[model samples]
Target: MAPTDVNRSTAPLSPAPAGGVPGWPTGLTGLGYGGDYNPEQWPQATRLEDVEMMIEAGVNIVSVAIFAWATLEPAEGEYDFDWLDEMMDRLHAAGIRVALATATASPPPWLTARHPEVLPQLADGTVLGQGGRQSYAVTHPLFREYAIRMATVMAERYKDHPALALWHVDNEIGCHVPRDYSDAAASAFRSWLAERYGSIDALNTAWGTAFWSQRYGTFEDVLPPRAAPTYANPTQQLDFDRFSSRALLGYYQDLRDALRAITPAVPITTNFMASSGTKGMDYFDWAGDLDVISNDHYTSAENPDRHIELAFSADLTRGIAGGQPWILMEHSTSAVNWQPRNRTKAPGEMLRNSLAHVARGADSVMFFQWRQSQAGAEKFHSAMVPHAGRESDVWNNTVALGQALKDLAPVKGSTVRSRVALVLDYEAWWASELDSHPTQALRYLDQAQALYKQLWLRGVSTDVVRPGSDLSGYDLVIVPTLYLVSDSGAANVAAVAERGGTVLVTYFSGIVTPEDHVRLGGYPGAFRDLLGIRTEEFYTLQADEQVSVTGTSGDLVGTFGADLWTEKTHLAGAQAVAVYDDGALAGLPAVTRNTVGSGAAWYAATRLDEAGTAALVEAVLADAGLTGEVEAPAGVEVVRRHGSGGASFLFVINHTGTDASVKASGRELLTGAAVSGDLTVAAGAVAVVQEG
Candidate 1:
């Protein structure tokens, strides 16, 4: 696939509007890195020195004032833009772009104390105080007004600043907890219900409140659904999740809209935490208004596959942006002190991870701080200049990374034309986890992630998408853990299956509607006919219990296990590709494939390990005419993104502790190396290759 083939998966191939999101500026040709620069916390003399150090470190973008809302707007009606003006001026003079934040992360202590209604409430029903940055109630008018005013003031002040590159909305909404249950949110929740279902009667039907006599007779009768040990309502929990998500979205939208009014040319974005069970803030919905999707990613050190998770997250951001370039809003330069065990990023780990983002289609790479803080919760987090100043190993690493990025700047915002796409939906995530019937082991993200690694390891370019997206171009469409499906959604898959495209729909699919009610007819309700299967029962098997299935073809010829959520499946016209090899329910259809009009739909009745799942998906992929162009060397990952001309860039990353060999058939731009299959990529090193 070439650069022109990039939009084949996208229904709309036309360029975005002049001032709209997705339009690349003239001469914009490379990646940008550096983020969260807070000079306000440092003295003027020290701050001036820090800027020079950041430049030496390859810092091109600076995210300013994420938690300075209180300082920006000290009094209810009074506003201050003096400090911001000076900061912008200095950054512009230094040739660094700015991601001007709304500074609404934390409300002033005075405001929260003055109007207690402004505080957020935890899911456990506890009112959160002003202890963290994410304690504001979304529905509070005071909070909204103050946030909008600050955003408006900032936009107006720096609308013409040459350094103003993007607008950073209020920092990570729902990062701390759910919405408040205060009078304002309670009242707004009722209004949100009215818009979603129109009337209490309709809401009752949608939620299936008829069960357990939970039907609502009036808006006033509604409350945040809390499940106790004795009683729990899945329908209510689902609704609250939806309501909470919408509440946070409303607050974010307000700020985004306000910024749009002032600077329509610049992109507006907010960072999101990945895989946080959709407590309702759908990244899709949030992405609709953002200029560029951005996020703050900090993974646990104990996980060796943290790099893979980071890739998945970067893909999620691209998915939200509809395949446009995303920004790595924040990553730690070294070990972060916030986590229980703060471990440093190995010698070249930061560069390795940052290149992973660029390989996956990130427009920029950024960190949490430019200089280490002497105070605050993140004071101990590693920075380019640690508290020990420029004499640290961290600072040296930062300078080295900066030089490397400059060397590899040719691939910024390049396109990776992929004919393979894996579907991931937050709506499905919210619906599935909110269910009470499924086994506790039926997790959503991990399952999708497992399948993601299959394509990733194979060096196949894969895009993560939601339902209703165009699937006409891809040879293979993989939907893992699609726990919820509407009538139209099922039809979307059916269309692709009918058009000679192979489809893989996994367990926990078609279980609920968008409103979270179980589909009326049966499991996999809307898709039953297309899938040619009906499930009569599903059981929770013990951890140690095992099942095996032999593949109908390919390397998957051996048996595999079905540990949890084993669905007793009945295939109609579909053939059983694998079966449970043990237990009383043994020899059942653990995996099946139904030939639709022109293609086929594969169904997995239970979760399997990465090797097993990848084997199954690869088997299906082979039938769809999909094949990888090259096999990346061990520990050396490869990905490509395209530009306008014949220039195609490829990122080769070595994320292991030991050096690895690579066979490069194309030109390697980073090293100016000629085509070959025999080259060594140093440990934690990155090579940017290009096609001229």
Candidate 2:
């Protein structure tokens, strides 16, 4: 059949919901199905063929021109939109929407050659060359000026285009060049510090510059804490991290303003790399700028627990977006090209992964590229239409997933609710990783994930939230390794327990302020009163070190062991629920619980093993009288999404190779069959049930 004879004019493309944010183009009738499209890479004939294949697979949207600055503007003051115009018109004619990108992520070679200062400099004083994406310094005046100019030109050209659905500001801000230690960045850092601290004396006190005679007489003397003789000031390094993130955000804001000036009605967003352990930018702070939150997530094929990490990232993104539906901007259809040994997805893995994001409040599931590239750095990256063409399994799965999304149209505006909130603060992550810490083996994300995995295994829904956010709605709040706490954040946690809510404070928490300075008087400073315990000192253990612990009462009666760290704590008013049997701190309080007002606060003073952590979490959940009724097997996941008018959808996913059963009663939306009692899900399968 010829490409033109397919007749996809009647394909489902619903209008944007009336309740959606203003200026955002709507009409996405079902889950969005598409990925990045680089039409300029292929010939005109091939581009047309790609569009035909997309229509056949029910692809309704494509993000275009993300890295096309070099092609869009070949020379200074020269602009070319002829190719992009034709592609947009063709896709629009085929009933495909466009998430048009501004192409500012990578500067053109000509611009880089003309303005070499725009290149970012490493901490060792090596200037990065052009060729790679995100090579320009975000604070460079020339770079920002040219980026805004290009963005304005693109916005003016495509603001009213029929195919334009949303404006993607730039491709994954801070992905490559997150930090630049160049002179320009240093100057910008000084200006940022001045704005933050007002005067030089204030900066000195906040940074504790009085130590080691590091006090500065002027802001100009401050550098980027780059490659120092020994340990650079921890507070200075923390501030530099903050400045670099804000610098990238400033660049994004410039382009966003340029787009908004021309197309006030069009919504704008930049894709965030919300991978686990990513600390470049604090996304919680950036989420407010986006009209619709979007994130790129890629799972590590080597990790045996990648699915749990995926669920954690999705839930965190949803929480950052204020419990609103966000976009799964980029994922892989099969194997990704970046890993050491890329592995292809198992039979139903792609579908299951996409549905996992949707199950956790993602409205769209998109990939990196629409079609595989024949030449480029990412030639091996998987796509909807792989190099094997339309007959391949990836293409078939794409078609099938698109059809399934049509059946899931009712889940568009649904949201997830949780009675448990796990505080995830980026400042704490940065502060804990600073040099001269008590234990070099302590990792922020690892500890948080350990607790999150336990909660997930227990079938308890949780929202990974910022500390300053409201905590009144939650029955149980878990603060995992929150090493740095602001006064307001500390007060927020205290208020949770004061308001009759159970709060759990983990080891290595509440040790420092937001400025990376330790809280004086005692260890675990700010939380000492709330937790009813005072830590006299921290005991860092070696790699092979282990300590024996036995619960004295309630759920802690069993004997368990902990490793990595321990604290010599004195109970103020809290009762010791568990104690270390052998160690220097033997017979001391290893875990304590205190009754505060109408609620209780629990504290753990050491890193517990998986079973121990699970047991402790079980005890905390019991205290709050909150436990999930569903007791799912190891690899099975159960999630619920609530919609308007009291409608709720339950998602049961089985990640194992064998069948898994869950007690569920609802109308299965996918199969249109009534489900009651035991619902057996096949291996690597998912079931979406709508509850009455």
Candidate 3:
């Protein structure tokens, strides 16, 4: 069954817009469906067949020219727009819009060979050679000049094309070449440092240069933290990570500005690798600059919990978009070519996966490519049309998903409102696990995914926001393993509790500043006042060691296990929610909850086991007034998206082995079945309802 039609417009499909910019494309009226189109790789006959197939699959948009620099300008300063023009014209004629790329993701061979200085270099000073993608250093002057020129040229040529919907700046900006330590990068880093610190002495103080007499005499004397005799400076490494992320963002701005100056009406964005696969670029800093938030996700076939991770990625992307509807720019239609063992999808898995993204907040669903490549490194990658052509499940699923999205037109422009906020700071994620910490077992995403997964399994939607965000509207705020925080940012989190909201802070958080300087007085120094607890020292447990904890008195009741960490924690004014029953800190408080103003602040001194975490989470949810009945069966998932006029669309996904049901009253969009009080869902299937 496909999605039911939600809108009765004159045209069910959309073409490239002719004018003003909207949240989505001006001309599109329904959920978007398409994939990447590399038309230059095929002949004219094949291109025609691809267009016909797209129409049959209900594709309304396609991303073109992402890695077409080599074809667009095979020679220096010489250009060819013939193939792109033909493709754009043909797609528009077939009612397919284009998310046009600048073709600057990778430079042409001629340019790279002519200006070898633009090549990226490793930390050991090995300059990367050509023959791969993303070969150019972002901060290299020549590379920036060439890429900016490329963006300007493409904007000038396609400014009037009818197939232009969105301007895809560059494909996955930091996927391959996230960091470079070349001479150009060194210069840029120095300039960035100078701007940030203003003086050499200030920079030395921030970097803690007095410890080993490593202070620099001038800005020019500094270099990247390259392969040294031993471990490099922690603060220097932290600063470079910040500088590199800024440098890439600056490069994107350079291109985006050029495109905006020429074509002011078209929206521009770049695909972000926001999934667990990438961690280099701080996407929170990149969100404000985007006209639309887009992300690419790939799940491992080996992970039994891949669906939960997908839910996390989608929710995090939607949060980055400020809870607005965004696009799923690229995902695998089946087994991807990159994993160690690429296993094909089971029956009905693809449909469930696509709807899961839509349930989270994706207005459009797209894949890596439209047709399976017969040649190149990604030839083994799955696509909408596999080598088996129309008979393959991939193609059949693609067609089904397309019609399903078209039927979800009413869901377009709706937003997902999350009352819970999970603080996720990229800088903190980078700094928390840096060398020379309390324990090597401390991982930022590990702690975050653990908490987020529990919430997901409970059918509770979450918003992953940057630390220091305004938490006024949220009833529950969770800060997980945040090792770095600014003073004002910490105050902002504290104010959340001051306003009668429940706040949960985990261990190893609030330990450092932005410059990697340890917070003085005590561990979790920033939140000590709010949490009403003091931690004297950290106890790092061995791999095989485990600890036991038990709940105390009223409201908090459970006896559970923990591992990998402990702390000599003493309660200041708060009561112990859970106390360590066995460990170095036996009989001391492992978890405490302090009433602040009218709200409460809870702290965990160690990583609790699964049962303990779930128990604690349940109590916190009750404290925040979020407790409720099971809306769906045990393994079934339910999320609602709110639209205008109190209208909501309920998405129910059944991941269990047998049939399950949830209570609701609505017209089912997927099967056109009427649901009243009880809604039945088959195993491993999905349903969407326009709830009244």
Candidate 4:
């Protein structure tokens, strides 16, 4: 198909604003590698130099005009396109594609100055100032109109341009101001609540508004869960979180629809901040609107397990794409500028990091920027071409990785092969960590990532999926700290067990409804029947308290140390796998397993340390009839992307200070090295094997 072809895919995502399955611009081939290209920052002479350098670095595509709204529309109802037109034509002549942004990411000072009403507001009734990015209130009508106008003009201009490969919506929606609490947002929230619950009476019942004399006779009286004297209604807060996420998504859809109306053939997408740092929008709910899923992930220099978090984010993105190939829109080539301590990457860690995402299912790997900015807020942020120019290691490595991606082009469009499904529910995450929870120490991301880290360390490929996604293909489904799950979501988890698959329900799961309503029955209200266990109360351990547990048989050991949380669990029909040997909940079930139809459901009633988690994960896999090393060699991560006709590419990433070997017989695409029995990957390096 050509770049402008309308018939791109036979199976397009429903409601695809782009009219087809979102993919790389129609004609571009090979794996994409580039970053944000801001030509406006450089002089005219530098434009040619950028293209030449891009060619030298093998950059096939660059995200242009992400923050060029001020330059694109200096004044309302006024436009300028000469510079952009010249730059786009120049890039087209150089054989480079563009992910042309709508340039509406940040509103210009003039627009905001004239329409201060469009600025976002905090819950405390304080209006956010201009100066920074993402300052416009997403729900404000005036802001949308102005943003849409800019997008409409961009679409009309570049709809037929040869260099236009993809339409980039406003960059990283809801990154700074996840939700606004201004009067404009309050009106929008009221309208959203009415649409959701239909009537004021229904909203009152769902929100349990009878408490604290909060009942409302009409939806007009409702406001966003803003600052209040006491604790705001939990259900109201949850709904506001939902509404806020939806509002931002609707804003994106507004831009996307305008672009789609003009350029129906071009794929449209906005870079989603899908990592732990971002908790505003549920990308699962936002995925159907995108033609292809694109995510922006930057590992924290503060985290030692940044690579694992990167894998988690990538898997979650693949899950959002329904296991299809997706684009890695933005990541850092080296250290990021935002962190207080922006530590640089260690030698080959860059290549390993990029390929790890690819191994997880990203077909197009790009970074935050092409050139390091000399001015502005992100001047110190690392880029493919740094302030030090093309002679540095960052530049040399950038060129080498580009060629490596070109060499590994065959892996494009393939799906990651994984049998373990990890449920990641943002709604549950939001509700589970609400202010009035039993334990403020119940960190949702920490628990989920820890479980994912175990799988990542074991050389297991895991897909981070949502609650209600189809789980039939998975052999094991792990639900970690899912404190809020709907009836259907709970059923989906049960179906995994009923259909002869293994499941593990961690502590503080299945406790509340979608509306933040507690289940009437025993604890783990949603999964009592499936797991055959009941909990009376959550015995939240003190900060320094510990509980000793014993495993049954050889799997049951001397002392299974547990901390942070313990539950008083009673077995309805499940047999105890581990018992609390000491502490207030002595002799109670710490871990229990039950046979549900042909499958099994295991529940962990308390938190476990790293070693205990590894063992329990091993046991769960054993029950699922799956096997892998519970303790694999340190620092070696393996993942396989499976293509059609039984073709598979094994990615062996060695993250330690020594060389690692993997058993495989094929060609390593990274270095084109032949492998017979053991594939050796150098320290801080990666190997992609086309296995026999």
Candidate 5:
């Protein structure tokens, strides 16, 4: 039977602390379905109906004022809060919480018209047209002033509003283009370079600009490296990336400080676009200012592995906030409107995806819209109530999911305890791509995604940790595509390996240092001795070239692309786990394992395919004595949350279309199910298995 959606009374909500909201709500873990709510857009008479429908579908919170800049401030010197005041009042009356947002993402038409300097310039010196939202540059002084003003106004006005729960900062700050090379941007870039290097000589040394006579005579000569074709210098590009990230941080900090002044009680967050170019914005720096880190995740429904990416994104946010529960600001209820083939989410996919986030440590869940728009860019975007309103199939599905969330409120605030951490570095991502390599097809995200899937299938709790994380407790640490490794990062890995922890280093790792400079002496620099291998020469092959490597022990076979930076290495103290069986450099080491100190480090000399990566991951985990610990069924996902209570709650979610067989050894918290052997779980089933 489809679950009947319940009202706010059953929607278990964690209250704010005595003084303020304590470290963001982490409880009765379930999905909260409502996004981009703008009651101001609809007639006042229609609000009650919307609220009734929302409550029936278990939507406890609404993300309001996403792009209301024009309405909030029609002119430069004036502000209006009449519509917003009424909207909040109506939500309060309906017992619905509000994710109050600063309507500064899209500047008012009048403000942009009056101050065109707020607009960003493209990389090739072309000025960006001011029509779309988030078109302004982060460093623009006028943009900063108006943005801060809007944020301050919202914070002060909603500071005491009982309905205000979470603060949604600027909407998708870097949605559009990346860096600009305008005169203003160039001036700011030069100042940033001056602060970073202190002098032109140091700058030259870092970029190795002397090789191409690109040495700067003065700081003024350094501009945002945006010119295309033959003029793209990777070193300059890296600096521009760092500069843009800092600039975005400044904008975020400005609004964060403003919100802090009035509403110190509620958490503030900005929704980050999950997959995008220009990794300039450091999520760590941005997350540090937020009470809860929120993200806008839209994935292809056709790909079964999309859930893995979603889990990875959630883990990334959790890592940034030190395991604080996060919110999903936008997710398509059925299918995405943006993709060419707008396929509807399968019968059980929506519920499955929602539970997957909970399994990964997501505290709150919401989508892009509650009701569909009649006409706009997102008119066709899937929502709780489609264009067909409450009569739609999507609406029914949404209502059923809401009822499930309300029933699972007892599982909220559960903490996740992970045994494996995959090291994902943005600096390495930038350095690897910025270095002009042989294969343009080598995608860093895809490689990281591949590794994540391997860990997921092995029933290991995994997290995408940053470069400098505490790796003492973890049994296995997987570092994929670690292209740029600083001395400190290398030291951390060494410590982990020396302390009897297994470390897996993949291809394209340890090529460059932190300052965008190539490591001196040998490739993989500080890690060469630890890895027990030295790579002297490297070559690249075509896209179709296959790398066939034979394993030394297990009949495990490995295959990967030989088209990207194929390295020839001599194993010093490491044992050859796999060797290239068929290639010009046949019988050479393609995969090696080195036993250093009390632990071991496995190095994959080439990028492996899905099957190959899984095998390698299984082998690594087995050697570390940490494989298949959590015995779960084929489609049933298992997750554990640990915290101050000294108890762990394992969530077993069956998001499959057919009945799933699930078995556990812990006491079942939701039902009095037996804690032994396998049990059949109905479609869209969720079970909280607790282990004290």
Candidate 6:
């Protein structure tokens, strides 16, 4: 069949106003409804059919040429933009904008075949083969040279194209090849350490080499903490992780600068993986390098609390962007291909998930690819258009979601206002997870997310912030297991309590410096003055063991179980609010509260279960003089996005199997119907109200 042409039309909606972030590219109008469009995978006739289907589904933007490196340049100096030009022109004629990717993520076979040294090496000195994507070493000079040249060529070619809306710089850095333990990596690590510590003596002192006789005579003597017979040096391993992240960031900066020099008008972004644990690169450190923040989120099908995890990732992404609206660059429409067992999404699940991202402050919702691949490693991955064509349920839901986003276009520039801030430090996460800890079961993200989940369940919006970020606007601040604390970070937490604000610090916190060295004065050494307590010893428990906690005063007047880790704490001046009921440390304080200046600081010396955590969070909320305005039913989420000049949009989402009702007054944006008094939302449905 021959390809058919179509006429161009204006965008469905208007561009969102540039929020506080200045120089934000203004090409996108309305919600962007599209995914990665790789026309190179299909025939030209099929490509035309895709455009028609995209127009039918109201997709206005598509990311193209993400992995087209081999096709874009068959030879070292060869350049070919003919096929790319045709696709761009066709999409422009169909009223669809393009997010042109640099196609430098995976270098071509020819380049790697010529220079096998570009391949990354594993910890055991095994060179990675070139069959998989992201196999090149980030520190390789030739790799950077080629990547910059490819990006520069693409930027210069598409700078003035009418369909170019945004520039996607090399897909998902540090995803597949986060670290390399080769000779090249060792040299780079030594250089990074020299810049950080200047002298070998300073490095030796920071690493505490005297304990293990691992002292380095010079920078060149240090290698990337590779696999040893026994356990590797923890401080050395931590520094290698930091160096690896910096090397990848250097590659991203090279490509970003190349694009910025050629196409200054276009916004540049690279999608970040906001997973629960450490993803090698600290997104908080990398967030500033992006013109617009974007993230790729995938829900765990096996986990029952997947929605809450999704919401956590979205909120963290928005917080990293300084509370500005971010882009949901990729999400599965149904089931993804990567998991051990891929479970399909239930009815209305897709719509609920996309709106969930928007409710948390995402301006655009997209996916990995537009059509399901017939072959490849991700052939089983679901897409906007499934294998069953336009008649499939995925297509129907896709169209419905498109219309829903069109109706909710007014939420584009609105900000999600949060009164509570939860400190998220990547450095603490890295240092706390090092080998040889008190308890390997204690994870940084798990403890932090547990408290954040409690606030979310109560319909209380909170922002995930860095440790050193400004906390003046928040009423309450929560720091969970912050093992690595710099001087400035500790001062920031103290300032929060001194300014008539409440703060909560959990167990195993403030135990180390930024260099992964223990503070040594007492446990939680950095926060002893503010918390008014000092820990004598750490009691690590087995998986099944738990200690009972009995409250003596305040809202914690009941029994709770504490597990994983416990600290024997003695209060200096603070009053004990909760005490251990049964254990060697019986009658000792498990929870303490102290007044600092005008505000108060609370410390939890042990891990608390769900109910206990919720009780503690509620008590802190009361201390901050804040409460949820609307009491929502179980499995239903309530959030508000505030626009300029007192206008607000209330998002009520029902993640339940049955219908739910809430008392509110406003006009529902989805249906344009008036909602007064009691509003009933259908099962797995969403109701966004525009309120004054």
lDDT (CA) for every model shown?
0.75, 0.87, 0.86, 0.86, 0.72, 0.86
Clashes by residue pair, model 4: 22-291, 551-556
lDDT of 1 at 184: 69
Q: Write the per-residue lDDT of candidate 6 for residues 405-465, one digit (tens) a residue.
A: 9999988899998889999888788888888999889788878889988888888898999
RMSD of 1: 5.4
Please provide, for model 5 over 385-461, each residue's C-alpha lDDT reduced to its tens digit, 9 standing for 90 to 100: 78887777888878877776665564567667777888877767776776466466666776677777777666678
RMSD of each: 5.4, 6.6, 6.5, 3.9, 6.8, 6.2
TM-score (all chains, Cα) for each model: 0.93, 0.96, 0.96, 0.96, 0.92, 0.96
TM-score of candidate 5 on Cα atoms, chains taken together: 0.92
lDDT of 2 by residue, 1-692 (tens): 11111011211122323554452335565778789999888998899899888888888888999999999999988888999999999999999989999998888889888899889988889899988788898887777788888999999998789898899988988887788998888888888898889999999999998899999999999999888789999999898888777787777777777787787767788899876847898888787678888999998989888889999999999888889998898999999989888989999999889999999999988998898999999999999889999889999998888887877888888989999999999888888888888888999887789989989888899998999999999999999899999988989999999999999999889888878878898878989999999999999799999998889986666778899999999999999999999989899988999999899999999988888898899999999989863778988989999988888888988999999999888888788889988788899998898886
Model 4 ranges with Cα > 4 A deviation = 1-22, 554-558, 629-632
- Tens digits of per-residue lDDT, candidate 1, 1-692, equal 11111001112212344744544322234677787887778788887787777767767788898888777777777867787788888887887888888888888888888877778766567778887677777777777787787788888888888888878888878877654667667777777777777888988888787787787789888876643554457666666676777777777777776777777767777887754233347777666656567877876687778888788877777777788877778888888986777788887788888778878877777888888899988888887778877788888877887777777777765767788888887777776775455576667786788887777777778888888888888888888878787778878878888998888888888777777766766667767887889888776678787666667643356666556767888888888888777776677888888899888888888887656787886787787877664566655678878887788876778877677776555666666778665657788888776766
lDDT for each residue of candidate 3 in 567-669, tens digit (9 for 90 to 100): 8888899889899887788899999999999999999888889888888788788888874234666668788899999999989888777898888888888
Backbone clash pairs in model 6 (N, Cα, C under 3 Å; residues 3+ apart or in different chains), count: 0
- Give the distance in Å from residue 525's predicted Cα in candidate 6 to where it truly belongs: 1.0
As for candidate 2, its clashing pairs are: 14-27, 14-29, 15-27, 16-26, 16-27, 23-265, 551-556
Q: Model 3 scores what on Cα lDDT?
A: 0.86
Ranking by lDDT: 2, 4, 6, 3, 1, 5
- Counted clashes in each candidate structure: 3, 7, 0, 2, 11, 0
lDDT score of model 2? 0.87
Candidate 1: regions farther than 4 A off: 1-29, 74-81, 227-232, 275-280, 552-555, 665-667, 676-678
Question: Candidate 4 on 1-692: residue-level lDDT in tens?
Answer: 11111111223234545445446666678888898999989998878899999999899989999999998887777878899999999989989999999999899999889999999999999999899998899788888888888899999988899999998999999899997998878888888888789889899989998889999998888988888987889999999999888888888877887888888888888899888888888889888778778999999988999999898999999998889999999988898989989989989988989999999898899997998999999999999999999789999999999999999998988888678999999999889878977888888987788888888877777888999998889999999999999999999999998989999999888888887888978989999999999999889988989988888743534466889999989999999999988888888999999899899999988888877888888788777877542223677888888888888898888888987776787888877878898777788888888875
